[model samples]
Target: MRDRHLYLLLLPGLLLILLFRYAPMYGIVIAFQEYNIFKGIMGSEWVGFAQFARLFRSPDFYEIMRNTVLISLYKLAASFSLPIILSLLLNELKHLVFKRVTQSVIYLPHFVSWVIFSGILISFLNPIDGLFNAILANFGSTPIDFLGSSAYFRSILVISDIYKEVGWGTIIYLAAIAGVNADLYEAARIDGANKGRQMWHVTLPAIRPVIIILVILSLANILEAGFQQVFLLYSPLVYDVGDIIDTYVYRVGIQEANYSYATAAGLFKSVVAMTLIITVNKLVKMSGQDGLW
Candidate 1:
């Protein structure tokens, strides 16, 4: 009876995953078919990799793929270590009030919608009468079009994304740090280890498993540059540098009504992401660390 109640508590979450996540996976069949709204899944003509071939042959394929990979990799390389660093720095703070206030200020941006955040970025980066240009003018520099320039778009995307999510990312690392045994720190102190040495030897090692798991999970989505943020921020002028896979799919699949082609691209991303996750997990296991498996 006790176990039955426990199972009952699991029902709602399981049902939600089945309904929203697993059930929608069936629609992937459209990737292999010439899907029509009226003809439906059962009636659609089977195409069998035609869409994939067309996607690969498309003129814009390499450019879109390049933009997607570069932006994702840049964000990962730049932002991934920041949260760990922030968590460690914050963990060392002795003043409770200051720590809480600092954390709250940093975390506030995470809850803001990308639509609003993008608008704020646009306003700040505007060439005329914008905050950035106003400051640049003071230094005797000409007003630069940050948003319209392809050269600046990727940098802006990375910086803005890091600003919004870095604090929220720190929460997980901070929690992991909090769970480290107090005795470990005491032992380090007794061994004449200073703050830096203690952090390097004790705290970092304690949180290594959490870091590995998060890194492995992030690898699964290595191709997913944020769709909402990119769509909101990018324009035709910056498409060469700012366009990503999700935004490309939205433009081609949803806007242009090339459903099968878009589906093929999406399916490709999913397969690659899954492969990355599995490979990374295997590598982690070989290195004698805990993995998602």
Candidate 2:
């Protein structure tokens, strides 16, 4: 009877998973079929990799794949480093009130909708009379079309993503840092270690496990570049640099109504992501560390 309460508590969550997540897995079958909404799943003809073949033959496939992987890699590297750097910098702040205030300000952007953020970014980066361009004018430089230009689009995407997510990322690291033993720091100080030395030797080592876990989990999401950010910021002109798989899927599948093609593309991303997660987890285990089980 004591176990009854735990089962009851878990029942709701389990039901939600079945409804929202597992139920959607059936839709993945559309990738292998000539999917038609009117004909439905059972009635649809089995195309047997026809859509995947079409996708591979498409002229844009290689470009989109290259852009997606490169953008995702850039975002991964920046996002991974930014949070750790923020947490470390914030940890060194001795003033509690100031630290809390700074954290709150930085984290506030994460709560804003990407739509609103995109609008704000467009206004700020506008080539004519925009604040950023205005500042550049002070240096006697021509205004840069940051959002529309292919050269600047990916960098802007990377930096903006880092800004919005970095603060929220710090929360996890901060929690890990908080759990570090103060006694270790005290001992380090007693041994004539400075603040930087103590942080390098003691605090970093204490939080290494948490860092490794987050890194492994992040590897699983290597295919997921920020969809909303990319969709909003990118124009046809910048498509070379800004086109990622998720955005490309939306454009081809949802906008163009190429359902089977979209499904195939999405399935490709999922398979790649799953393989990466499994490979990375194995690597971590080989290095004598725990990873996703």
Predicted structure with the largest lDDT when compared to the true one? 1
Model 2 clash pairs are none
lDDT of each: 0.93, 0.89
RMSD to native for every prediction?
Answer: 1.0, 1.3
lDDT (10s digit) by residue, model 2, range 199-252: 799988898888888888888888888898999989999888778888888998
In candidate 1, which residue ranges exceed 4 Å CA deviation?
none
Which candidate has the top score in TM-score? 1
**Candidate 2 to truth, TM:** 0.96
The per-residue C-alpha lDDT of model 1 at residue 71 equals: 89
Residue lDDT tens for model 1, 1-293: 86999999999999999999999899999999988878998999999999899889988889999999998888887667999999999999999999999999999999999999999999999999889999999999999999999889999999999999999999999999999999999999999999999999999999999999999888888999989999999999998898888998899887988888889999999999999999999999999998998
